[model samples]
Target: MKALVTTEDSGFGLRMADVPEPEPRPGQALVEVRAVAVNRGELSMMAMLPPGSQLGWDIAGTVLRPAADGSGPAAGTRVTGLADGAGWSELAAADTARLTPVPDDLDWTAATAIPVVGLTALYALRHAGLLLGRTVLVTGAGGGVGRMAVQLAAASGARVVAWVGSAERAKGLRELGAAAVSTYDAEETGPVDVLVDSVGGQVLNRAYRLVVPGGKVIVYGNTTRSELNLPVDWGHARPGVQLRYVHLFHELPAHPVTRDLGFLVQRVADGLLDPQVATVAPWTDAEPALRALAQRQVNGKVVLTI
Candidate 1:
């Protein structure tokens, strides 16, 4: 099978290589990957990955074989889900518990966009204790997880305030249900009931200060700054405010990955949620697609067709 692998000499730190096909384990299913999504986190780690290692986390495809334990969808079923790695290949071994059935009508590009980013947005909102009529602020709203957070927060009846890097990217954020969309440099003085932050560094610090006294602030990504600096008086100034950090892989066991991904897939099928695919290119163009993603040029999810 041809898979996208990390290479030390490649300019993008990635190249195509022939690799052995994966075999399903007792609780895993072997999937014939149809599409995969590119994420900034994975791209950032490319240089550090072992040579020839497969790289990707989100995938949508058909199940070629069921789990040995009889716990997952049968062979020939369409599915989409998160993988530990190796999703960039033509075949990937997916944990049955993390696999979600894809709607028959949904395209591979759209379905592939829902796994990692969708689950991250959903879980972040849940961690923040989102409630109807509450005010929610989402930073880095132009990115995949940020865009999903905006729409999901609004669908849940929260007033959403989106922070993006450019005015051009803020155009359709309101139509997606954001009550207000502003540049990251814009001032946001009002207190929010919940803050979902994907951009770390200064943005995270600023958003954290805006959470209401008893509200929660959930930090998920550190796209801008590797080292996040918080206010010196953060703990004392907002004693009641709860600060939580989410690493999706670590929380998968506590949450139902399959059930959550399935719900989001259904929402997309019903037109209530949008996967917001920004670019679709063949897997052969993985280098350029990854370059664009690393440059932060994409407004939404970027899918590579197999």
Candidate 2:
């Protein structure tokens, strides 16, 4: 088996190497990975892991073996899942609860884009409660999660406003159902019913004020990695406003991963949702794609075909 593992190298911090095949537990299934998606979370995890550590989450593939407990899909079924790690490999042992059958209509590369970003956006929006006829603003609207958030929010009948870091990233958001797309520094005159902030720091500071009275703010990721300083009187002055930070894994226990993935995959199959892939390259090209993602050069998910 071969996998992309963390390394001490100064470049992408990852390299492909032969590794032992994973042994699926009773509640896990062995999947033959066809593709994987690059996410900021895995890249951030790279710095904390020792050399040779397996790091990956999103995977799309076929089930080589069903779980011993007879919980997961049958063998040979096409599936996409969120693995704890070792997903960027020939095979991965994924929990049955985290795995979902990938519809034949959904391409493997597109299926790879579903788990992390799609699930995160779904969960974040779920935390926002009702979105019908309300305004929902998404910051970092260029990235994978942000793009998915925009489409999902719009589909929920919310008036979507997407905020990106660059004008180049703002392209196609309107077509994807955003009412308006603005750059981070652009002035937004209207208040929103819900604010999904992925870019923290100054972007968050400003967006925080845009939430109308009784609105909700869901903070999932801080791509900017800067401190958030809110005025002391800000919270006091905003009545019924709520601020919530969603950790996908923490929320997963309450939300069925398979059910959510089924909905997303169906939407994609039905042409209601877009995976928004920025690039699809061989697994060997992962380093460059990952670099582009880290630099915020890509507008959406970077998929690596195995």
Candidate 3:
């Protein structure tokens, strides 16, 4: 079986290599992957993982084999799932708990984009309590998760303020439900009820200050990979403010991954949600796709066809 493996030699730290096929456990299903989504998190993981380690999370494909425990979808079912670091392979084993069946009409690229990006936005907004008639600020709003966050927040009746890195990346965000789209230097005033920040560092520090009292700031991905330095008076000045760190694995048991995935897929089918695929290419072009993502050259999810 051929899979993308971490390697120091590649510019993006990933390269295709022949590896032994995965063996599914009793609670896992073997999926013949047709498409996979590349994410910024995977690039960060490559820095910590050893060479040759399989590193991918979002995958969409057909079930080659059902879970041995008879808990998941039947064989040959089309599905989109979260992989435990081996999704880049042609065949990857996914736990039944994380697999969600996709409609036959859904494109593979769109299906593969749901797992991480959609769930992150869904869960982050859920943590913010009621969004109706509130102001929501989404940092890194041009990215995949950010785009989803903007739409979901707006759908919940919140006034969404999107913060992107540049003007060029700000296109189409307003149509997706953002009330205002601002770049890094834009002067955005007024307080927000909730903040969804993926671009860490200075953006996070600035956004946290914008959250009104009793508001929440949900931190998911630190794309900038910089240390956070908040004001020393944070505890005293902001009495009811809350800061949360959300990771999908940590929150997986709190809600059914399969159920959430189904909701996202159904939303896409109904045209209520957009996957926002920016690049679609064969797996042979993984390096360029990853590089583009890493460099912020693309504004949405990059799909690699297996």
12-104: candidate 2 lDDT, tens digit per residue? 799889999999889999999999999999889999999999989999999999999999899999999887688999999999999999889
The global C-alpha lDDT for each of the candidates, from Candidate 1 onward, is 0.87, 0.90, 0.90
> Which model is ahead, 1 or 2, in terms of TM-score?
2
lDDT, residue 292, candidate 3:
83
RMSD of every prediction: 1.4, 1.2, 1.4
The CA lDDT at 84 in model 1 is 60
Error of 1 at 288 (Å): 1.8
| Over 4 Å off, model 3 | none
- Evaluate model 3: give its lDDT: 0.90
Q: At residue 123, what lDDT does model 1 achieve?
A: 85
